[model samples]
Target: MPHDENSTAGRVATQERIETLEADTEIPAPDLDTRPPSSGATRQANDDLRSLEAGLDRLQTDPEHAPRAWQRFTTSVLPPILFVLALIAAWQLYVVIAQPRPDIVPGPLDVLAAMSQAWESGRLQTAVLTSLERGVVGFLIAVVVGTPLGLLLAEVKPLRRAVGPIISGLQVLPSVAWVPAAILWFGLTDATVYFVVLMGATPSIVNGLIAGVEQVPPQLRRVGTVLGAGRTRLATLVVLPAALPGYVAGLKQGWAFSWRSLMAAEIIAVGGTIGFGLGSMLQQSRELADIGGVLAAVLVILFIGILIELVFFAPLERRMLRRRGLLGGTR
Candidate 1:
């Protein structure tokens, strides 16, 4: 009986000791309703995030912060106008100071007079219109041909490997270098001009599209595949849209090349039924020793290039950037 009682007492003592140890070592359950106090760094980070969100929201909603149409127009136009005027003034000053022969370095007024004469003779309009028509036609053909060529090159590795260096080499080759071959092939016709233009423009466009395709993230392709898109659908719908910026850059460069090639062809491929272009006018003036006429023709070419950029490419680029939210603030 005494032994049983001693054993029970020992068991009770052991139980009490376990309970005390557990009470000493146990951690309190975390409060579900109460959060820990934030540190200074955490509070500062939260404040910065909120500020950024508010700024973005204001940018989206506020019209007053955006530039007005007239403001934008003035900002774009005024600087160029001022620069032109300054250039004209400098040219006039140089003519007055140097007293160079009119045949060698004509004054701005002399060039203007030459321009007036050309205008009165209707040659200026004819030259501009002819060149513009050829340029537009050639550029359209290039776009049609190049877009597909570029896509194929970008998608097909073996083809790209075979032709990629050739394309790049062609781009580097002067468009003027092709004129002799083109003339020999097409025999001093509009076909020659178009051929040179195509040679000049197509490579740039193909390379551009290839570059754009390379820049497309792999994740985008995987996502399209997962979403049940075929190769064509993935390329057309996803890749093309993402590659637009590079493609547009290529297009702009292609047009420049086309214009330059056309000029070279017109200058060299003379004495046929081909219509007189700006280059033809310039060459004629040079042959006639008419410095004023040459300058006038050159100015007309410059003006046409500026006009096309302002009217078409600039607005197109701006719209694309704005739509993609890549353009921020008042453009």
Candidate 2:
């Protein structure tokens, strides 16, 4: 009788504790023997990760191709074309409406007619060819002479400390200022023109080269040295190739300097046995009071500049940037 009474008391005490916990917290009791396996929890986590991986794979696979042809035409081609057309229209309108004195500003139609006249007589072609030949030859000479000098100046700290400021100073000096000195050095001939172009352009090209060479990664140089590359081999295989983009950029700027220098030389050093260039043509047009001819010649000069930049430098620059992956999605 005593053992039965003790057991009943213990059971009643346990039941009361359970009821108190459930009533106080409104919580259900957990089944201790029925917990989820660790592997099942891990499998759920992996399924979530797989879903995330699938999302990433889809993003990478989605294509972002180049613009469609019509889209390209609308965005790229149309704006410039429209701008040029608008400029032409405005010029024509100004001529038609205001009718500026013919000697000062010629009408568009008048300029067109003058262009046709020059073309038929073959003088226009000759002048263009002469100017273009001079510009190209002078630019090539600047590149040849300036590139090595620039490389030296950039790579050699002593050279840079000595001549870097001088180079930048030369860039600011007007190409026209070189004309008087060039004439004194080479006399009034193509030699004088070439000298002026060289003086004007070489500094810019050299500076560009120097900057490019300076920007080459030191880590790359170290890597080359570690790989047993000798001085010449390192420069050829590592430095030059690495610095090519900057070199090309310098070439573009050098060409602009050369063109300007040639124009200055042609205009100031006129009256010789040499044939007509665009600059000389413009000078003659002014003397003859032929504003139409002047405008035509100016347009031709602008066209030449655009032609060279678009045809040569633009593609070259794009290729260099592409090789470095800097321009991967840009086009």
Candidates' lDDT values, in order?
0.88, 0.83
Candidate 1 off by > 4 Å: 1-66
What is the clash count of model 2?
A: 0
State candidate 1's TM-score. Answer: 0.80
lDDT of 2 by residue, 1-331 (tens): 4545665775555554443322325544465247653588877998899999999999888565755779867866799999999999999899899978987888888889999999999889998999999999988888889988887887789989999999899999988897788777777788888888898999989987887787899999999999999999998899998888788888889988888888778878876554588888888887887888988988888898888998899879977887686675745
How does residue 109 of candidate 1 score in lDDT? 99
**Residue 232 shift from truth in candidate 2, angstroms:** 1.6
